[model samples]
Target chain A: MDWQAIRLSLWLATLTTVSLLVLGLPLAYWLATSRRRWKFLVEAVVAMPLVLPPTVLGFYLLMAMGPRSPFGRAWESLFGRTLPFSFEGLLLASVLYSLPFMIQPLAAAFAAVDRGLVEASWCLGESRLRTFLRVIAPLSWAGILTGVVLSFAHTLGEFGVVLMVGGNLPGRTRTVSIAIYDQVQAMDYAPAARTAALLLGVSFLVLTFTYALRRRQRKPWTLI
Target chain B: MDAHLTPSPQLLADAERRYRGGPTVEARFDIPEPGFSVTVLFGPSGSGKTTALRLLAGLERADRGSIRFGGATWSDAARGLHCPPQARNLGFLPQAYSLFPHLSVSANLGYGLASLSARERRARVDELLALLDLRDLEARHPGELSGGQQQRVALGRALARKPALLLLDEPLSALDRPSQVRLRKELRSLLRTLDIPTVLVTHDRAEALQLGDRLVVMDQGRVCQCGDIQQVFDRPTDPAVATILGVETVVRGRIESIVGGMATLSVGSARIFAADPGGLGWEVFICIRGEDVAVERGSTPGSGSTARNRLPARITALNPEGSLVRLSLDCGFPLESLVTRQACADLGLSEGDGVCAVLKAAAVHLIPHD
Candidate 1:
């Protein structure tokens, strides 16, 4: 098995999950509460990843992060490096691929909170930020946890976007999925099976834990 | 405006709002004296009672008007001045689900005490728990407690802030009848001890009567009457106010004569005397509540009774409403009387039975025909 590819995949997944969480919290909250006229437009854009093919999304991202694009030129100027086929490129691709996984659950959770509870918090002299932290955060922990775990797992299994953007750069961007694909094409069935088994086991464990936690939180009496 | 005339140090409000698909509310009210008193905003559903409370609490903005709470301008649309709910420093207990479901009862009580020291916060929480009889449930979350317990916790949390004003919007409407009655009494006593101005909005007449020190009758987004509880209950400003107060009988009468302080009025061949004789030869409405109309057996009016207005009537219908019996009488004009079930049984009262409906002249309220 290619341990380097496994390490790269884990790092990319962790970084993508963290960045998605940071970006998704406010976006989800705004979607849940804002009454702006164009809110649905933003919501649709966020959910585009769920419906569009991963390769299609990665194709646009690849062009956007290339040297000819303004963003790509700015990135090279500021960071002193190109974005295409680098670790940062793969990380950005993974974040976009897993954006919906991080936002949908969070938006639903926030929207499900009793509005009366929010108003009551405000009436008790709590600011909106404090109410979100002290009341909304605790109530929506389950959705947040679901979003985090789903994002991590989805990013780990990414293939089409990583290949479209990273271009099989060996140790730099060759994640576990690309390694398995390369091994399979080279007629190396043993290594491919081992790597595939590892991914399956990790995904199973994460999904099992999330499902169990959700079940316990939903029907607390079942825990007893 | 006189330079020496200072604004009164009371809670005054004049608010107007027009919703796109809902009612247009134009409410104007002033509490010239606001201290340690419960002012009930009573009306039917869709009457804008809750809207008025929300405007006072800054939960909803008014289109045009100003609110001055004890000399501080909370909201003034003309000047574009408004205070958010957080800065208003007021407690609001909604109809239900006011307690934070995730917080323990004690933590819920301690939430608004961010300015207090840790020790003081704990002491304050403990004091509220004891005062609200919630000491045993301090560790329980809102979901773990009963509805009545949750309501008590919500009340305790609201009072924990020692807010400048307390706004309660049907706080007891979600409880069962027995729990509602029990909690209302407890709330009345608890509110009496606190020296805060309270505005409670309720659609229940019984709750309003039992809890209100001052009453404001609202109808169609307007305050129809505002006065002391008994005075408003006794003499509503108009027919709409009387109907909202659950005044059972409202019969039109023509003033016949005014001898001394008593005024004799004729109602469809029946004579009734009222305590007020403002103007003779004018039509007026004689309003009386079901509970104030006493019933006695036989057609002969109580011989030695002091009640000046006694009419012989025939019982048309009898309704058993829990502990009390409602008797529909036809004393020339329609009238209703509410009596205890025991009194109903002792008199052997039934439909088509003849009885004397004794209404004291003082109980007879007169509202001039509009």
Candidate 2:
């Protein structure tokens, strides 16, 4: 059944989701509020993953993380480990693949906040950081939750990019999607069916939770 | 108690800022009297009244200006000193009552009192809840409250920090007429009790007259006139200022003659008498408020009246605004007069009827035409 691959894939997805959240929040906030002329340039770059083929992006990432590249050489000298075909490489690839899942919803949420509320907070003598945390964060919880769930599920189902970067190494980089492919090639229908069913169930459960949360937000009395 | 022994600090602001594709604001304001007084910046919609308040609160920066509140220099462009809004030690209430939708009323009030101890913060919030009469709704969120209730909560939140100065931008413009009137009285008493210097911005002249001890009239991003409420209303410096102050009838006239400090102005075919507060050019505008002009039907000219100027006019239109009636009259020149409904009924005034419009020389003001 290759349970180790399933576990590795889950771990990679969880780590990628957490890291994307930590990095995407501030980036989305800046994109929403900044009046800079070049803001659309950054937005276009972030949205590239949503339209680009996963294998094409993976090919470029593979080149960037190779031994001859400056970043790759610096990483090797610092950590004594190369990036490609490693779990860390897979995590980074998944984060980039799922970047739009984290940022777009969050940017929309932040832009929806009342500008007057933010100005009032400053007038009440609150620093920008304090106002973001105390006022903006709580109000945008629904959108943030949606972003988190989508990022997590997208990373869980990742295949083409993970395959191109992580390179199908058992117990090291072989994710559940790679395991399913390997099982189908080996004519092992039973384990392939089992892994496919598991993935489907998990994805369905995540979507159900997202929908339930949205419905609850619409009728807040249900929360009490 | 000892702080009161020292003289109150004045707020002096002289700043100019130009918005991209918007109006340019050049403001020069000095309020020598401080402590628990409401100063209204009154003007039309685009006159930069809100801009002036924002500059004072450090919400908007000015190009090459200085703001000094007593000894503390809030902004000095040449010296490169500019304080951020958080450090300005003032409370601001924007036009929209910006209550935090996620926070309860009590939490919203407590959001600004971070400097106080936990117990002290609770005490302060409780005090504001009581002061604003928001004790019963402390646990409710802003969305659950009515518009007036949310406004009070916003005010309480601003006041919770015990700021040195308070700035309000059209605080009552969002309310209905009945609620606006009720909340205005409540807000006046609340401001008196807080005893903090306040700068309020409004396009409404009645609000300025009722709430402000000192009124600054702005037009086209400049201070057109500034003085006590009565002084500004009675004697506007220019025709623009007079127009903004709600003078209904402003007729351009050339001075026909000046006799004994009184000027006879030839407005169209009618001669209007006005006090010549000397130094006025030959061309001036005679400003008369609608309420100040009295209407009498079929009254003999210069009979049973001591008014200096009386003209026979035919009524053109009659508009009933609530309890008062506004009559448009054509006495060779357009004139408007406001009278109570009872007075309108007693005079039996109607359209196409001839009536005499009585203008006291003292009530008629002359301003230099722009």
Candidate 3:
């Protein structure tokens, strides 16, 4: 049983979660409140991953991260190396795949806030930023938690994107899901079964823990 | 001996409000609008009364307008000055009475005074709890309180800031009718004691009349009329004002005589006298209350009566009041008269029959139309 693959997967998931939250908070905020021109176009693009096949998204990620693309060249210039087949490549792919899971719930949570509550806070003399942090963030904490958990879980379970872009480099790009696939192909049935069981148990425990936490918090769950 | 009157330090300082136009809101009045003690923007639903309160709160900005309060200019479009809402120092109570759901009443009251020292904050919160008669409820969350209690908590929270300008946007409208009346009375006294220029926005005319020192009648977006409640009620400049104030009976008639400085006129199908003197053939609008008319049986005998105006009327319909009967009569043009149930029974008055309608000239108000 290769432990590096498991460690890499955990690292990838953690990095993916952090990056997604950092990038997604602003994006979700914009999606929730922006009255900018062509807002719907941005929304449609953000939602593309939800409906588009994972391989299609993975294929686009491959093209964009490849040396043939402008973004790829910029990354190469800045990073001094190609992004594909690297841990950085796996991290980028996971962030893209998990973006919607983090954003949709957060956006919906922000949207569900009582507009009057926000207005009242402003009238009470709280600044807009202060109101968002003190009133909105706390009020939508459950949804934000749900988003983080879902995004982290989804990133951990990522198969297509990691497989297409990872190149299965031990201790670097080879994550747990790909490791299990490799083990089964090599006729290492016991190791493959153990890795699969670990993944399944982790996923189940994560989902159950979130559900229990949400139930205990008794947050006012909304449909959208 | 002439005593010098000192201008209120607060009055000399005005709160500022800046908005970009989404709702009607309160704007501070450093240079106050003339003849208005507290300009209460009032109208029916969607009439922008709450919007005006929001403007005063600096919660929203007007595309154009100035809000000056407590010797400060909050918003001035031409001068390019706009103050953010909190800087305006407005104690605002939105329509819902939004006390912080998470916090206890004491905590909610102390929220605005976070910058104050702990002891002072506690003292302030305690004082507010006592002031609002919420001492027992200080430890209770907003969800556990009754609607009226929640409103009191919200009021306490707003008042804790000791703001120079107070803006109440239908603060009592959400409570029960009895609670509304009680809280409204309490609010009036509390506001009066503060000496803070307050703007109350409500769709109810009665509420406006009850709460506002000066009423600003707004329709659509324009200020239609702004004046003392009684003054506006006594002489509305337009039919719109008259209608909004519930002074609906407008009888156009020709003046037949001017005796003792009184105009004796034939109105609709009835002869009536008004306190206003006018020449013959003069047309005017005479306003009379439905309760002013006294009903009598047909072919009544002439008797000693101080009533100035009398007309023979046929009762077309009888509507019920609490303990009185409201009779609709065809006395030239349909006239409404209220009589006690006992009077209705004694006079044997029912629908479609004869009756004499008697009223005093003092009971009528006259508006000249040319």
Give per-model TM-scores: 0.81, 0.80, 0.75
Clashing pairs in 2: none
What ranking of all candidate models by DockQ puts the best one first?
Answer: 1, 2, 3
lDDT by residue for model 1 (B1-370), tens:
7636965848888888779898877657777676688889999998999889989988888889999898789999999888999988888898875787767899889988877999999999999999888899889878899888888888888888888888899989999987876677678777878878889999987678667778899998888998787678655678699678887776668888878889888987789899973532376667788998999999775578888988999999999988999899999888889999999999999999999999899998775532
lDDT of 2 by residue, B83-160 (tens): 989988888988888888877899899988877888999999999998889999999988899989988888888888
Error of 3 at B139 (Å): 2.4
Each prediction's whole-model lDDT (CA): 0.86, 0.85, 0.75
Cα deviation of B304, candidate 1, in Å: 15
Instruction: Give residue B45's error in model 1 in angstroms.
Output: 1.5
Between candidates 1 and 3, which one is better according to lDDT?
Answer: 1
* Candidate 1 vs candidate 2, lDDT winner: 1
DockQ of 1: 0.54
Q: lDDT tens string, model 3, A104-163?
A: 999998898788777767767777777777667777777898999999999888888888
Model 3: lDDT of residue B46: 69
Task: State residue A216's C-alpha deviation in candidate 1, in Å.
Answer: 1.9
